[model samples]
Target: MERLYQGIVRFRESDYQSHKDLFKELGQSQSPHTLFIGCSDSRVVPNLITQTLPGELFVIRNVANIVPPYRDTNDYVATLSAIEYAVKALNVENIVVCGHSNCGGCNALFAPEETLNAVPHVKKWLEISHGVKEKILREYPDADAQKREWMTEQMNVVQQMKNLLSYPYIKERYQEGKLSILGWYYIIETGEVFSYNKESMEFELVTDTFTP
Candidate 1:
């Protein structure tokens, strides 16, 4: 806690001070161009990775970076509300879903329910795993594998992209060509990002020239 406090103090004295005018302008209001959704893992800092300053990226992060299928469920309503606000109100031009390697949530997906519910909510949250789990079981039932989990992580990004499309406002923007939805995989160890190409149904290396 003390370290966090000191970091804030440093921000106020240094980074904030240096960007004081930009901060002052942002204080009036914000119209960020992107909505970046990623996991709440400490290792995944959206702003740091993107090098976007305050008021530049509106972000929503949750366990496993999961975006549940759109429905009338009481759960995930808050997250959906944020997405509505970002796409409809803020009119952000981009929505990026980023997943990272070595994610605990991804790893834990392979474990049994009894061992998982030390935090019941985590178990429930990752229940987004249902379809993916069935796929793995049906495809590779005999294997114990991290590769299977990795495949799920990749698919999960695509699935969340589908979930994002479930919101009508996003769909409208997409149809009009005002917005782009991106699914990204960030390799933690290598500092490389792979982008999902809808046309190819594959993830391709994001070249160095690419901003994302």
Candidate 2:
């Protein structure tokens, strides 16, 4: 806790001071251009990875970076509510679904039911992406653990991108070319990011000169 407080002090003295005007302007209103949906992993820092400053990206993070298919319900839906506000209210032009290598949520999908039972809520939340494991098994029943892990991470990103389209506003904007949806797979240790290509159905390396 002290470490976090010290970090805040450092930010207030250094990074915050340097960006004082930007912060001041952001205090009144924010018009972020993208909605970045990423995992709740400590290592997956969306702003740091994207090199985006304040008021540029609205982020929503959760276990596995899951995006449940659009639904009408009276229940409390935190992730869905955030998506709605970012799109309908904030009018973000882009939405990114980022998944990373060696994701614990991905690993959790393959865990035995007995193991998952211990974390009931997490188990229920991950059910949204359970089809990812089924698809991998159906295609490569003999795939080893390493192969399965990477595949799960990448496939989960694409699955969430599809799930995002299930939202009526997002789908309309997407078809009208008013909105862009991207699926990214990040390799933590190597600091590499791969963006999915809808045309080729592959994840290609994102380089300095890369054009999406």
Candidate 3:
């Protein structure tokens, strides 16, 4: 808590002062360009990785970076509401679903009943990506633990990207070429990012000349 307090003090004195004008302008309203859906992992810093500043990316972080398929229901949906607001109200042009290597949430999907029983809500939320687990198992039946981890993480990103388009607004905008969806796989320890190429059906390493 003390460390966080000191960091806040530094932010107010230094970072905030440096960006005072931008902050003041953003205080009035935010028009972010992208909606970044990513994991709640401490290591995956979306702004830091993307080199984006405040108000540039509207972010949604949750376990496994899941996006539930579009459904008309009376239930309260936090992530779904946020996505709607970003696309319809903020008019974000792009939506990026990022999944990272060695994701605990991805692993949790394969955990035993006792393991997941400890976090019932998380287990329930992860059901959104249950198809990811099934696909991985069906497609890579011979894969070992390490192979399964990366495959699950990468495939989960693709699954969420598909789920995003289930939203009517997103699908319409996408078909009209007014919007873009990107799936990314980030390697935490090595700091290498890979972008999914839908046509190639592969996760290509993001390099100097790479374009999303």
Stretches of model 1 off by over 4 angstroms after superposition: 73-76, 140-144, 209-212
TM-score of model 2 relative to the true fold?
0.99
Query: Tens digit of lDDT per residue, candidate 3, span 1-212?
Result: 99999999999999999999999999999999999999999999999999988999999999999999999988999999999999999999999999998899999999999999999999999998899999999999999999999999998999999999899999999999999999999999999999999999999999999876
Ranked candidates (TM-score, high to low)? 2, 3, 1
Best by lDDT: 2
Residue pairs whose backbone atoms clash in candidate 2: none
lDDT of each: 0.86, 0.96, 0.95
Span of ten consecutive residues with least summed lDDT in model 3: 123-132
Distance (Å) between predicted and true CA of 2, model 3? Answer: 0.8
Q: After superposition, how far is residue 160 of candidate 3 from its true place, in Å?
A: 0.6
lDDT of 2 by residue, 50-132 (tens): 99999999999999999999999999999999999999999999999999998999999999999999999999999999899
lDDT for model 2, please. 0.96
Clashes of each: 0, 0, 0
Per-residue accuracy of model 1 over 30-131 as CA lDDT, tens digit each: 999999999989899999888899998999999878887667666547678888899889989999999988887877777877789787888888888577
- What's model 1's lDDT at 162? 87
